[model samples]
Target: MHPRSLRHRMEKAAKLLVIIQKHTPEVDCLFAPEKGEQGHVVCEFSGSGMSRSNILQLGKDLEARGYQFTRKANPWLGQLSYTGKADEKPTIILSLPVVKDRVAINEDTPATPYSFKEA
Candidate 1:
């Protein structure tokens, strides 16, 4: 890789680390490779430790930090983007799992419009 690109990536990673520590210390974040115009950060919370409200709070916290959020195809997943003076804005892909046994689904329950498919 070019030296300039590597330096830019390092800078971005450093910035993200501080943001994550301050805004979302409860969740685990995996920094993904940059593609095209954006850097990707994948976040998933621990199964037993996380609640739906916690996930919702993360979204709110991110928004408060100046990131705009866009819901993904999955209800539990969404993308948050922040565009500053940086050449490539960071895009956080947050995936929160549905806690098992938390919601009881019955035959009378209506199916969701989204297809729950694996990526």
Candidate 2:
């Protein structure tokens, strides 16, 4: 069984997922595909270089909802944490699924590159 806190985190993640899906569009999905690791929020973005305006907009939207980013990788990848709770807690991580758009197709280009079951 998962810890209660983890459950809470996932619940929060679900809410964030709604927020991300509502905000992100496929066209602008360059830097981020459909989802990426984020606090309680699985998010998608435009690209590294303003490829999609949704990313910037999402930042603003997140701010409006009272979530301040904690850390990251490079300038555009890594982690996110809630405000005020920075001092406490061990660590918070958001696991977002890799976007299919970024995946490179092989010579055949199967419909689904990754499969849970091998036939």
Candidate 3:
């Protein structure tokens, strides 16, 4: 594809991301597609409180709007892709990292002895 065409697609994807951001209060970041790559945007969530649910719902909404989608694993639990022409449309990747509860280790605990001595 021509360089200009790729730029146009990226712009469109960025615009779509902005529109989506307006309705998604939990989105923490928005990244536009890089050069020479298919149109893609990343919607990152804080992954705390209602963020997980919100991102999941957003994924569902995208699917309902005729976007083909797939569930991502690990850190990013959500993703969506447009069903239309690949060259003309953009793919939305949802990033909702799993938030683990922080636990404070006892400070008084002794460190484990190393198997080998270090100089």
Candidate 4:
């Protein structure tokens, strides 16, 4: 790589994860989709040690810290199964959108729909 290009790459590499960490801590993170943007984030959390109330409170705390989240649910047509039983593990989906300078809702309407397909 050219010297300038190598430096630019290194600078970005050092900053990229710092930015993500600043925005998204272990509890949760938030971000918004732009026009013509599409992607997804899968977050794995440890709930094996905490009580039910502790887990729920952690979610609430993350929300208060400004993360937008929704419980992951079964697809409209059917639920996904592991082995023979349906996978009922709880998950949270986060999205960040802004209107003007303040944060706004990233809602889908009848005209525009959002869907996810997993393999």
lDDT of each: 0.52, 0.36, 0.50, 0.31
Write model 3 residue lDDT over 1-119, tens digit each, in one string.
67897678767777666656655865564444563355667666554344444544555555555555544233122222222223446766555555332342222223232111120
Q: Can you write out model 4's per-residue Cα lDDT over 42-119, one digit (the tens) per residue?
A: 223332233334434544544443444433222331222111101221123432221232222243223222222111
lDDT (10s digit) by residue, model 2, range 15-88: 55555556554422212221223222233332323233555455456556654444322212222212211221
Model 1 per-residue lDDT tens digits across residues 21-80: 665677777765454444566676644366656556556555555565544333222322
The TM-score, computed over Cα atoms with residue i paired to residue i, of candidate 4 is 0.27
Off by over 4 Å in 3: 1-3, 35-37, 47-53, 75-87, 99-119
Backbone clashes in model 3, listed as residue pairs = none
Query: Which pairs of residues have clashing backbones in candidate 4?
Result: 31-96, 32-96
RMSD per model, one decimal: 8.7, 14.1, 14.4, 15.9
Q: Which stretches of candidate 2 lie over 4 Å from their true place?
A: 1-3, 25-51, 70-119
| Top-lDDT candidate index | 1
Candidate 2, position 32, lDDT: 21
Residue 49 in candidate 3, Cα distance off native in Å = 6.2
Question: What TM-score does structure 3 among the candidates reach?
Answer: 0.52
Which of the two candidates, 1 or 3, achieves a greater lDDT against the reference? 1
TM-score, cand. 2: 0.40
Ranking by TM-score: 1, 3, 2, 4
Off by over 4 Å in 1: 51-54, 73-87, 99-119
Of 3 and 4, the candidate ranking higher by TM-score: 3
